[model samples]
Target: MRIHLSSVFVDDQEKALRFYTDVLGFVKKNEVPIGEHRWLTVVSPEDPDGTELLLEPDVHPAVKPYTTALVEDGIPAAAFAVDDVHAEFERLRGHGVRFTQEPLEIGPITTAVLDDTCGNLIQIVHTA
Candidate 1:
């Protein structure tokens, strides 16, 4: 089966949506109300019909600790491939995005980590 969807835990849905769509330039794919929270998802502009990234709520008590540890350890919940890591990093920084790791060369790839402001660290990478 083909990969269709992946999720990144977020503390706030609205804020996460704004960051993903406004800052990162992803397009909103769907938002369906499900009980206490909504099933919100977004897709890259270049792949509007491709895999959707679900902005899952961290309602569970354990989620906060898990998310914090991951971010502090520089483990990204998800990675977005970009054309230029430096340009993308600059663009994101201009939008007030807080980055934990600056752009650095790692073997055959260049990557940077940014705080999604939603209890998660997201990675942006470009192939070298």
Candidate 2:
């Protein structure tokens, strides 16, 4: 079977929506109200019908510590594939996005890590 949906725990759904859409260029796919949080999801503009990335709220007690440990260890919460890691890194850096790891080539793959500003480190990757 193929992948369907994936998620990134976010401290603020609204801010994550803005960053994921306005900055990263994803488009909103679904938004349904669910009690205190909304079931929000986004899809790539290039493939709107492809996999959906859910902007899940990190309200669970274990989430904070988990995310905190990941950040402290310089681990990325999620990774997104880009056509050009260097170009994408430049574009994102121009948008004032803070990057923990600059674009580095490791064999045929290149990657860069940036903070989402919503308590998550997101990685952009490309393979040659």
Which candidate number has the best lDDT?
Answer: 2
Poorest 10 consecutive residues of model 1 by lDDT? Answer: 65-74
How many steric clashes between backbone atoms does each model show? 0, 0
Q: Per-residue CA lDDT of candidate 1, range 1-128, in tens?
A: 98899999999999999989999999999999999899999999899999999999999899999988997788999999999999999999998999999999999899999999988989999997
Compared with the true structure, what per-residue lDDT tens digits does model 2 show for residues 1-128? 98889999999999999999999999999999999999999999999999999999999999999999999999999999999999999999999999999999999999999999999999999999
Best by TM-score: 2
C-alpha lDDT of candidate 1 relative to the true structure:
0.93
TM-score of 1: 0.96
